[model samples]
Target: MKYPLFITQHGELKRESNSLVFSGELIKKAIPLAQISEIHCLARVSLTSGAIDILSEKSIPVHFYTTKGDYKGSFINDASPRGKLHLKQAEHYLNPEKRAYIAQQMVQGIQNNMAFTLSRWGINPVKLNSISVEGSSMEELMGIEAQLWNLYYAYFGEVLGVKDFKRTRRPPEDEINALISYGNGVVYGLALSSVLKAGLDPSIGFLHEPSEKRYSLALDIADVFKPLYVFSTIKALIKNKVMKRSDFSRNKNSVYLSREGKRKFLEALTDTLRRTVYYKPWRRSMSYRFMMDYEARRLVRHLKGKSKYKAFKPWWR
Candidate 1:
């Protein structure tokens, strides 16, 4: 299958018949429609109205990114007629009990994966009620998820070998947080594309609150993958000294990957996505890139009542 493409330079995207053309000061590329699943504009990338129209017609998702690698928003095609799947999703949403169940599962999946990552380093998370989602209300569930993240970040210093690596956003205060912001953008972009590919509504979510422009479902789904896809990759890059303090720059109250650093991080992330994993049940190997789409299909199966939904959490068995 075609893959998601990342555009990291100042460029203009235009429609060229059946292909998409990206024109940059240093290079130009025209990718055929058949060879692309989605496009993420990482920096100063503008698009023509024709490009937007054609992209929508083709049902390809496009996401915009800020310079620091935060997800700005996405332009998704107006979904074509949903046969029955969306109706089922709405039913789940309107029912408080069902929605809470899915939300709890999502939090459980993320916490379990976080614990797995910690286990890989032979480090145990300081015991906290961080993994349980058996909350009495939606507010309580959200509070539990938030608390787990604090507990999760507590180990960043030990695991990533970066000192004082607290989670920071808006303007990331340090190098690792900056990398994470960028890495999270990557995760969200890929998640959004895969959700679109599976014909799922990105706005209607389980764990995260649905809002005006945010793809909450993508955020919710991405939680399960970020530890493996983003954090592990970050750990590798830092431990290998491939990324250093020199790769980052400080702005007013924020740190961001320099253009060169952004290039380095994206290259590493692309390599991570292409890395193969052995899917035991199928007894075949698939790239990490495929997992996003796989999860989308799994969610569909659960929604259709063919099976119970189980979020994939990478762990050593």
Candidate 2:
């Protein structure tokens, strides 16, 4: 099965015939192009032109992240372009009522997933029920979403036994914040891959307004799944006492995961995505990764008026 390839060491990626090889100081590995769903470079990895050509030919996306785990950008090959679907997607964005509906649904999904996850963690998030999704304007809707997340963060910190936890970004102020920032970036990259596979413009989003060099639609979709995948992984790691203090490093006031830390986290995250769960629409089990792609396709169907779009709400295991 194809899986995401993560490069955590500084290396050079070269195309060796039909396979891609990573050459670093202490490690050398070759991966068949057929076995990779996506590539994420979390370190300073240089790609050869030949490698780029093959990846483009295969329509494989390569996501780049800074040393601090901030999403820099992505190299995506637009192999399939559905012009008609693009028009329908833009039409939905152009219509205020349609845009509002989609945005509300996305927020509702985020809320539901957040509450469900919290409950599973033995934290009853009754406060999320008080927040209303029937906001008339985009600002009001966004405000409600922000409020929900704030409450979530508070509960998340409490359950994790992290005192006075606050969400900080860029240069994360604490270890948990660093993990959240990095995990969210990974989720966003996965969502962007799904949007590209669905042939949708990632920049055009319903909840998040389109901005330069930003895949806002992926951000909107990623929000729904963050609680399910990202936070869940973190919780498991903490509960199992798998992550050590040495896994993190501090530079002045900022804290970030060390190289070993990323490897451990990514391993856990991959397992989370790979686990199969029952999907009601399909009436069968599906991986979390597949569910993300399916969610994007469902949005496309909604844009084409073939069906009403519903955000994914997994059956908690």
Candidate 3:
């Protein structure tokens, strides 16, 4: 089984003894039960009481939205944190030196991910031209980091067949922006899930500020994997022509995804993660979903000090 989404249209979901069946005038097909992690209702849809109970039992989250794709909210069956571990996490955050240590770890994670990315493309890991490395200082590390991400976006353009694509600034102004935002959203969700599984306080993060609404820790961790998850999908979409310029709409200063565009983007993202990726750190490569779960375990290990904290390096070289 794989990750699945159960989208509801004009019908209600009902649970049978062994299966979930949809009933209504516009009951769409049910996705495979084992593969489903989420059920997104794009329309005003109903669910039988029995179906709700079953969904809760399965630990699947249901997200509701209007017909026009306005996000209403999500129904999560399990949202608890590990109370004991969360206390320790809070204590760590309150101490200045401890926070700085964690911050150093966070930076290391980012650097390691950059190293991994450069290694993937067979690019030189260190900036030889910039400085003679006595084994790589912070400045040389930053230089290499900049170069790796530039190459990452270059790969994005090549993958998507967008000859004129540029790496976007914040708030996203074009089709590329829409894909980037959607991909980052997926990354955040996956990271949040990982944080929850690790028993960490998602609001308290090493690399990101705690003042924001988002789980800062999740955002920090998401940065490590966002390029791989989102950029790669954009490339695939372009290669298959699953999406086109017509799928986007421009207002004064920003571009937004049309309904069809959102559907296609989500489909591409799901498919991309399900595709197997070879990760050298893990002797046997796994799917993106498994990679996400592995990151959660990594965070746990970092807190417990069983393994050193390292960020994801891009698979570019």
Candidate 4:
């Protein structure tokens, strides 16, 4: 199976035949086109237009992130040029009723996944009952999700061996918050690549209103997987002693991971993607990465009216 390629160093990516060659101070490596399903640049990385052409031709999306693992944007070659799928997607967004339904589904998915995570860690997810998606307004849904996540994250502090923690951003105030900020970026890159594979217009979304250079569809998808893929992985890493406080560096109030810390997180993320889980409908196991692309295709079917949209829920072991 093909895997997403992540470059965590300051490197130059160039095209070499049907492959990508990376030249950097510490490492010079070549990656065949077939082995790379997607690409994520985690730090200062440069790519030539020739390399971009190759990736575009292959329909592979490349996501760019800051050295701090904040999402910058993505290079997704527009392969779906105002086709039938795009029309349906636009129609759904334009119709307030349809848009509201999808928004509800997205929030429901996120809340359900959060509850599942808490349950798996032996916490009572019943606290999520305080929030609901019964209203029409997007504000209600967003508010409900926020409240539910507050409870969910409260449990995360216990599972990850942290205390009295609150999720913060904009130069994360603490190490835990810094890790979450970084991990969310990881999941967003995965979501965008999946959207590209499904030929969906990431800008036109069901939940978030489309904004300049913001892939709102990816934002919607990332919400569902964050609890399962990103947060779960972080919890396991810290709880199992794979990562420790020394991995992070704090300058004043700004908390960030060092290069070695970044490498360890990426390696753990790779393992999380490769790990298999039972897919209830298929009754077979698939990797987390494959499931993400499959979910994107499922969304396309839902938009086409061929099937109803269903959120991905963890079938815990």
lDDT of every model, 2 decimals: 0.80, 0.86, 0.64, 0.82
Superposed by TM-score, candidate 2 places the C-alpha of residue 127 at a distance from the truth, in angstroms, of 1.0
- Which scores better on TM-score, 3 or 4? 4
lDDT of 1 at 267: 80
lDDT of 2 at 292: 81
Clashes of each: 0, 0, 11, 0
lDDT of 3 by residue, 203-247 (tens): 887656686567788876777777556666776677677887778
**Tens digits of per-residue lDDT for model 2, 224-309:** 89998899899988888888889999998888998889888888888888878776767888887777888899899899889998
Against the true structure, what is each candidate's TM-score?
0.86, 0.92, 0.73, 0.90
Ranking by TM-score: 2, 4, 1, 3
Q: Model 2, 145: alpha-carbon shift in Å?
A: 0.3
- Model 1 segments more than 4 A misplaced: 14-21, 30-35, 46-58, 73-75, 126-130, 133-139, 315-317
Q: What is the lDDT of candidate 1?
A: 0.80
List RMSD in Å for every model shown: 3.0, 2.0, 5.0, 2.3
Better model by lDDT, 1 or 2? 2
Clashing pairs in 1: none
Clashes of 4: 0
Winning model by TM-score: 2
lDDT of 1 at 297: 83
Please report how far candidate 4 places residue 215 from its true position, in Å.
Answer: 2.6
Q: lDDT per residue, candidate 1, 101-194, as tens digits?
A: 7887788777877887777777877564335565547888888888878777878677766565579988788788888988988898888878
